[model samples]
Target: MSDKAKLVLGDKTVELPVFTGSEGEKAIDITKLRAETGFVTLDSGYMNTGACTSAVTFLDGELGILKYRGHSIEELAEKSSFLETSYLVFYGKLPTASELKVFEEKIASYNDVPEGIKTMIKAFPKDAHPMAVLSSNMVSLSAYYHDLCAQDLTPAQKDEVIVQLMGQLKVVAAYAYRHSQGLEFIKSDGSLDYCSDFIYMMTGNKNVSKEVAKALDVLLILHVDHEQNCSTSSVRMVGSSKANIFATISAGVDALWGPLHGGANQAVLEMLEEIKNSGKDYKTFLAEVKDKNSSSRLMGFGHRVYKNFDPRAKIIKVACDSVLKTLGVKDPLLDIAKGLEEVALRDEYFVSRKLYPNVDFYSGIIYRALGIPTNMFTVMFAMGRLPGWLAQWKEMVEQSGFKICRPRQIFTGDTKNTYIEIKSRS
Candidate 1:
């Protein structure tokens, strides 16, 4: 027996013997800590947890590599459409010619929400947040598809539900917006592409140029899946409790509502509005972000992972320029965003943190150009990530050895206290 820590990561087991320091104190080589445990913290003060070794996506932060279903993200952004990438992420492969066709047909078929659901949506106050309505509507979907909730459902039945959820999420999301605005529900056009149809459903118009649709598609692809992110983890945790898919995904939606997560895009717009209202130019806004006392943060900047930079942001930057240029839309905020990125990149704090503009940065500008309200941005995100969460939930159940997720908490309350009866006290 060695007096060292043992860790297990993935399938690897490693044991390290205790180290004796010169002062007779035990010590660990902070810089030499290797990943051995499935999920253990290293002496270097970084967490190492084996969430899952997913074959669905690979992210190499140092190398700036991101792949979905084994295809390079750059390739997908340029060549493959968003729906195709979505199919890749959910189904674990690029859809073939016939498969893509059938997949599009299946998605197109689910373009309209039921009238009852729309009616229910209309009952909510117009002032209610769109995300709240979306979350409620998503949970309500399970009640409508009560038959699909059977525990002993066949594989075919499960796949059908998955397809249904992916397709219907758009309708549910768009209807939430329309219902809030007192506008009539716009049905999806079977002829237009998936993202184009979704944009049409929300805008009540089919005038989305091909360029805008393509940009929106790339944006959707970028957000499709990020391995074990907060919202994704929320879905898995809820699913681990044996909750039905709809409920699990609804929980995920609630998690994504946080300002730091899917809500970041909304925050970005808010920050931009603040800067605009302040009468500050790009330089002044950049300085404010750098000042510690100012306590102002450049929204849409920085990320948790990808210490080098966010690959998705890079892709979106290109697409953002192209879409805005092609549409002849002039947004000064775009220039301000670019200036902020430039100043942050040259600064020390941002460089050390590997903070870069993430998917949230360009997303708001694109949504603005498309006539989608800022409040609806996260709803759109929820719609795009639905397939990813569903696929993860399915994979977690089918392939991965599932476990009930229950985390521990350190107790801090008083151990004991005396209580007196009310009558006795009186």
Candidate 2:
């Protein structure tokens, strides 16, 4: 509404320029706040802060809008494959027919991971968490491709690294899944496309149905990119120091491994199990969630970013029904999930609070139908989020005004303290 926002102090005034994005999202430029007025804004968790302006994805949480490079998510999910969407996220444009053919062929050519990496993966315990294994191998990739991540690298060299990582990470995830199950690792099939190959490797089912492959492709597309999520920010923070992609992505994997970040789907399943085991009806459990008297809480029903419905949830809900019906899955847990969602939508308490089912709500249920274990939930999330992290990191490297992400903090501890010898203190 205004070109600049004015803040008044006792005797001085500060004017910060108000910047609006292409989607009409506004953020005040606070870069000069500390310098001009010796005051820095304190925004814990950066909920209201604009850390950086990104051109990769646009999200309006209140309106439930999410778009990647100007394409509506629904369009991509219905029409494009994961590889095509990933290329769009990475390069900020959809690949042309010829470009798509070349990119897919190149990815196929670099499918298998290094043998040494596989040997190392085998050494981990069979019960080892897949995310840990995935991160370890991703970091180890730096050693195998040192030249690509070396200093003074060219744009073409970095692109090679990106391509290699994108293709091989699928292999790495498949290996991690097989490793966790103590199953022999399977090589990627050159005949399969990206999502199909991943499904094949994970399940060792040569004839994965067309429905399953399309389901996974849409899932990946829905999660292709979100604007500056925690793991993506973690990636940009580490990459700001000019870290190698492997190391930076490893940081992201660790961040996503946290329960609060990428484990919501697992938490959702655990919550469902808790409710089912408690012998309480869905309505009773939901009442406890609203009452707060019981220690019960609803997981995956709401998101921190979105105050309205999660746009992805709308699409995924339809896909969830289709996948289950097509596969003839009849899990009682899914029935419970559906029951919970139905009750939440009809109840006034949930509707007033905007606590509708988020994307993780349905994604978890579908993954269960697809036979993905609770432990591998976050690993699957990492696979979907890979392109977003890479796109953010690459933008930081090529764009201007990005530096090592060091935040200013208010000093609340003792300003000065004398070092006391142990005897003297006693």
Candidate 3:
């Protein structure tokens, strides 16, 4: 190890003595960090830590670049299918022809979730959110497969666990959506491709055009994995505790259901509906977003990590235009979204912060076009992200020296407050 500490900022570098404290103590230890996993940054903002270099997605926040298993996201979205991308993320390579065929068959075969699971889903409250139903159902699956927890599961069985769970998430997602509305659940058609099948399952009528299905396919593919993202990180953190994949993934689904993370798409649509109900023009709404006094932010217009742009947003924008044109469906909210994107991209505050639209920006539009309810948006996200969580869980179990995640904090509360006598009231 180098004795000197090197600090590189932008193009400048400075060397200082390595930090070490007095006898039997330590000042700082840079050796513990996994620098190769991503470009190291010394920011006072937040410290994101994880394993050393690993095979998975790569995200460059400043450049707005995302790659999955060495393939550019744009390329994958345009040229690859969702199932193929998912296989790559999990297995670390694009599947061969036979492998791809077998994988597809495996997933399609498991499309039907157990009737007991469906029955349990119906017992949920009618007004329950789809994400909640989906998460609860996923945890319930643990009971059905409790035997796997104790047995020495084989590698092939592990693969089966991931593939089946990926397929079953779509079933659970669709069932939750239709169940909440008291609509009859739609069954999956084996002939239809993955995205088309998901759409068909929600909407009994299979009227989706080939072009629209293709766009939806790409959307699902692009969203399949984002390395070390909040929810994925949560999944790995929970999996580190030796939880089964189903339980760990359920935890991830619950985490993603939060408003600040995967639920942003649903929140964006709700915000748009609110803006429309306000009886204000798009320009007026844009003005409100700009007004610091209002403290109103344009939902889906910015991201926490992607400082320059959100790559998924770019792909979905193209799909949005295509789907709208192909379906000839026009909603006033689409126009508002376009206008907001234009205004936010050019504004100084957004420019300075490098804030741009994210995946949530166009996702709601696509869901609306597909006849999916706005409330089910995060369910769709959960469906797509399930594979990523499983892959991370498997990788963590197979490789990393995993342990239960219990972070420590320095306590600054009253150290020696005396307990008052209950009988001696003042």
Candidate 4:
């Protein structure tokens, strides 16, 4: 195999070194392309770009494989708790029993937020989107924990912040849900496990079913990390500027608020609701999705990275069914979701295109079964994704020869326009 790729610009030729990842993925290093050739590659949306090399998560979209710290996501989801998975994603190894206990204790210790954060949550209008409340409160944590925002943090200080964020984000997510519903906030006493405690706080139900908590834990494990996604990229971009961890995570939260990212699950729920309310069967709606002229889309039916199938979706789908059965919640939207998935799986139009159900499809169903409102869906995503964002930030700052993210742009607009006075302008 060639160690370098040859590029020809007019009569000049240059060799760019080739880099290969552990998973056999290859990229031609273009670090010096613009400097040597006075040109840059144009990759809109960064679809083919490798922003940074990472060891936190490995995603083989073509094969529908996802792993954290070299451990398969399936194993983690089945055998490990969310907290355990979080430790693996952040620390790059599965924790021993004693190490896990210490990690859990540290997370539980920081579960409660300061009173000012509660006040901040109350100040938002009841109708404000939970993502807005989440992002705002996430950034405000820096004001409460000065060490988290310090420009120069010791390794111990950084570790503490990681633990603090893993714990507090769950509390904030529950608070955002309660605030949106005009309910009183429930404080975590740290008696239950991470997912159980979150369920207790969100619903004020001390004895949430173990199955429900475990299902939520699985969902969180599934979402812990995905290569360089939009939100993770946002975290890296902000962290590259030497921004505080709180602010960097806040940027990620804001990015996840977009419908194209973390809000995907919420959109899936809305699509199900629309089908139910319209009195249309899943087949009828899917027909519209097949029509090129119709604007209707089969939300959660496909993924950007996983063209074959979403590995997380396979796990979450089972959890979704189990939760529905355990809760005995007769939700019509869930029925509609199930119907859509059943038909889409065998439908040639969908099969040929590989438009299988992704993680977002059934996650909303599980959340709904757990009594989580639609608006709070993204908040749950932010909570699950907290560890991933922190891990990405930590990796960026700790990397050797770290450079701030500054992408080059090809300007197409007029560059030499003469300035015109306001009165003379047409």
TM-score of each: 0.86, 0.95, 0.87, 0.96
Clashing pairs in 3: 21-27
Can you give the lDDT of residue 400 in candidate 3? 50
Q: In model 2, which regions exceed 4 Å deviation?
A: 287-296, 346-349, 424-426
| Among all candidates shown, the one with the greatest lDDT | 4
* Candidates sorted on TM-score, descending: 4, 2, 3, 1
lDDT score of residue 264 within candidate 2:
81
Q: What tens digits encode model 1's per-residue C-alpha lDDT throughout 1-426? A: 357766565676566666653224354432234343324232221234435545677776666777787678888888988677778877887879999898888878887767778888889998899889888877888888878776545788777877788788888887888877889888888898888888888877788788878777877888888877888889988888878777888899999998888998999988887877787776677777778898667778876667677888888888878788888999887887787678778877778777878889888888887778899989878877877787787778776556777543445699997799888885
Clashing pairs in 1: 7-36, 7-37, 8-36, 8-37, 8-38, 9-37, 9-38
lDDT of 3 by residue, 17-42 (tens): 45532222223344433342333335
Give per-residue CA lDDT, model 4, range 1-426, as digits (tens): 898999999999999999999888899999999999999999999989999999899898889999999999999998999888888888898899999999999999987789999999999999999899989998999898876687757889888999998888888888888888899998896889998898888888889888888888899899999879999999999989888988999999999988778898899999888888888877888899899999767888877788888999999988877888888877777778888889888888899887888888989989988888899888888888989998888888888989999999999998798989999999
List residue ranges in candidate 4 displaced over 4 A.
290-296, 345-353
Give stretches of model 3 more than 4 Å off: 1-53, 281-295
Screening candidate 4 with a backbone cut-off below 3 angstroms (N, C-alpha, C), the clashing residue pairs are none
Please give the CA lDDT of all the candidate structures. 0.78, 0.84, 0.80, 0.89
